[model samples]
Target: MTRTDGRLQVALVALCAAVFLDSMDLSLMGVALPAIGRDLSLPESTLQWLMSGYAVAYGGFLLLGGRIADLFGRRRVFLLSLAGATGYTAGLIASGLLTEISWRLVFFLPVPIALLVLAAAPLVLPRGVRPPGAREGFDAVGAVAVTGGVLLLVFALTEKSWPAGVVAVLLLGAFVVIERRRSAPLVPLEVFRSGTVGAANLAALAWACATIGWQFVAVLYLQQVLDYTPLTTGLGIVPMGLAIVITANLAGRLISRYGLGRVAAAGMLIQGAGILLFLRAGATGDYLTVLLPALVVHGIGNGLSFPSLNIAAVAGLPDERQGLASGLVTSAVQIGAGIGVAVLASMMTLGGSTLAGYRIAFLMAGGFSLIGALAAAFGLRPRRPAPVPAPTV
Candidate 1:
């Protein structure tokens, strides 16, 4: 690895910080879903779309975001993205359109803007720029295939009229055929061939869907089942925020010392256990017992594993391909969380009280996490080969 000058180091840190904030912002809504849904008179089915909508918008455009970022510069796009994301998130908080509100604003607005800024960030240092053909990257066919598969999975969870899942699957199958023949792909054909970064990313996506999606369902449980107010539901998730803050730094260090594979697996497994606790929740369950404990465990799980996944996703890429790798890894996370919340939310029914629906969601989260664990165990190796360093973008 080459040494970074002060400006490059600052830029990296700034972008990473923005990523953390964006990540938190995305999950924060899940914590309020129950209260928000009840207040808005939304059905569980409708709630599912709220999550899914953001995901579709984000996933659909990820490739373009990365490509643009590579052309523009990472720093510039990163800052602009931050501005747009902050603005749009505020819009979601303030908007009163109800279901008519566009989820696209919620998801697509920020990252793409960030990518644009990121693509432009390299202006600070002349050395940061790289010539084209330094290495081949961006597997277009792979991008289509992955996108199709993801969208299909998301569609399968939806009860919408469009049957988007079927289309997604067909598109994905076709994408697979395309990738086999294409030379420069969006997702390198070789990356998918490896169990480590590729599979870990997949597991990260699944785990994210389960863990991050919980806020929506759990919040609903608090308000609908326990009769907590919106403010209170927000407060309920506050503990999760605190836990993340406290543990993320520690998790980073643990990954440094113990390696990401074993540590991330443990974090995910523990989170799965936390979801099981939610399954045991009842209408009359105490708040401290049922809610706080589960969130603590879940939060710890998230804190421990997240950074590792981020690092893993771009581990072996050549220097110039960093932007693509970063974009793909992040796209997977947002898309996964979006789909998980959407699909699981669709499963919610009024057949039982808030407690009942929440239980099912938690179980679903656990299943996702378990799948992540298996994928991580088999695919994600912590001993990353030296990175193919990114251009300034």
Candidate 2:
């Protein structure tokens, strides 16, 4: 193979590793939350913030990050972002082991790995084809307003603070007004003119809401309701991740044959079914009969739908707006995750028994997935048939 090809491979691996780390961190935290709460004497409401806070921050700033990537260099921005992601495929098992000793170690797992990735990034990641000009018209007001609004919105939902919710609404409204006036907005409103981008983003948002909320509730159910240890909980969750890894490898081929809309909608429907199965779970639920089957089904559907949502969001966009499209979809996911977790956490406080609350949360999550399925099915524009060539032979 050529040296250039080898370098590209290395870059792909690095990017994949960073993504893995980010994903694993979320899962790892879910498993570790119970342990952390017990040790720190925190409640479920406070524990939910550990996940939602990250989601809000990540979602809120992504538009700015995307714009910065356009203004600065994508590679540079990528490296900077890599500094934050921590954990990988083994994180679930590792988190279990570490939490047995101390929960702090689980939080620290990504530090050295992140440093190593950063050290190698400069060598492997390609530089931009063109340097950016001196005049950079970044919409600072829009960025701040949006980010602050999202933060406050999450806080309001989580804490049930009406004042914060009002402020959040005001800030978000101001952000829209600012974006309309700005020369270079963080997110160009015109991008939504394409039905595909809007629908895909909406689908992604709902998918995240269902998937993230289900995970949060499931983790709690395993530990608090079922009285499972951290190690057992992680091991049980491993099958779902494995299923996702396997199915995601095949999703591209499936999408090629069935088209994004069908595959995406089918995946969401399947995922919704899987989540609904969790409603059968109770204090005496059997892992093999109940949890394992549900998890595998959910993972398969998640793998199929997740990649399709990302691709659909950027499918018809111009090359220049590709970064913006990516950022917008990702922001939708993060925001949806925050909202889902917050809403589910509130649901968990309702009903007479803890088990009842969990069932309610699972039901709500399933509903979210159904909504995502409908969006994917009906909102996305179908691809037109290619022209047939004349028989010239």
Candidate 3:
């Protein structure tokens, strides 16, 4: 591979790892919440904030992070964010909330603070100290919408049903309006304008939403319904991670040959299939026969689609527009995640039991994935690269 290609590959891998660990860390803490509550003297009222804080912090600043990278330097911003998060973690540990600070330290500090660094790193590296691009500017608006929606969602989270949902819808509509009107909009109008690109991104949003939703449901299924310990739950889900690694390599080679439409359609199909399988899993089903295989398929689908979707979404954009392209993709991902969680939260409230909630979530995931599959199959028709301008004779 060429040097630049090598860097992107290496960087993408690292970025994936960082994002993975960040996600796992937040999940891990949820797994450990019972222990934390027992030891820290945390008030029942404030306990959920650990997860909420991270969500808020990560979602809140992602666009700002992208903008900073666009205007300043990505490498520099990443380095600083890394340093800042490290320091934040240290301070968080030292604060000793169990003795004094309590939920305030545990919930509001380390998790989000660390993520602020993690979120900033990707944006900074891609854009750097240069023009962020018209599309990027557009995506920044999308970023704000994403952040506002998250905040409103979180603020309204742990509350009654209708009120939270209403707030979420309103904020989402406001965000969409802002995105449409902004000159250098947060997400490029063109992204949505291009049928292939638009379809890919919207499909990505659905897939991501379903991905996060299912993962959330799966963990709850293992822990709350089946009464598995946190470690056991983590072990059960480990196969999916392994599957993603193996499948992504295979998908990379397949994409240039098959086209993004076929690959993405396959991804959505696999994702929907996985969720369908999970929905059928009873409180007493065997993990190996049901959950394991489903996860493996789901992981492969995600791995195949993730990188290729990025490639397709940004195809044919000018170099100046690269940052905007990246931002749009990033914003879509974050917004999808937050929306998924909110939707699942609503389902859980309606169902009451962990299993019932999980069933509802899996169903939603399956439906969304199917929609994504349909979009991929029908919406994308690949275009040949535009002819280059001729050199002067």
Best candidate (score: TM-score): 2
TM-scores of the models, in the order given: 0.78, 0.91, 0.75
Residue range 334-371, candidate 1, lDDT tens digits? 78877877766765663475556666777888888888
Clashing pairs in 2: none
lDDT of 3 at 147: 74
Q: Which number leads on lDDT?
A: 2
Better by TM-score, candidate 2 or 1: 2
- Return whichever of 2 and 3 wins on TM-score: 2
lDDT accuracy of residue 351 in candidate 1: 43
Error of 2 at 37 (Å): 0.9
In candidate 3, what are the lDDT values of residues 102-167, reduced to their tens digit?
433434444554565466455434653455452333255566665766766655754545676577
Model 2 segments more than 4 A misplaced: 83-101, 130-134, 383-393
Backbone clashes, each candidate: 38, 0, 14
lDDT, candidate 1, at 24: 50
Whole-model Cα lDDT of every candidate shown, in order: 0.68, 0.86, 0.67
Instruction: Report the error of model 1 at residue 90, Å.
Output: 7.5
> Which regions of candidate 3 are displaced past 4 Å?
1-53, 96-129, 132-146, 153-185, 351-354, 384-393
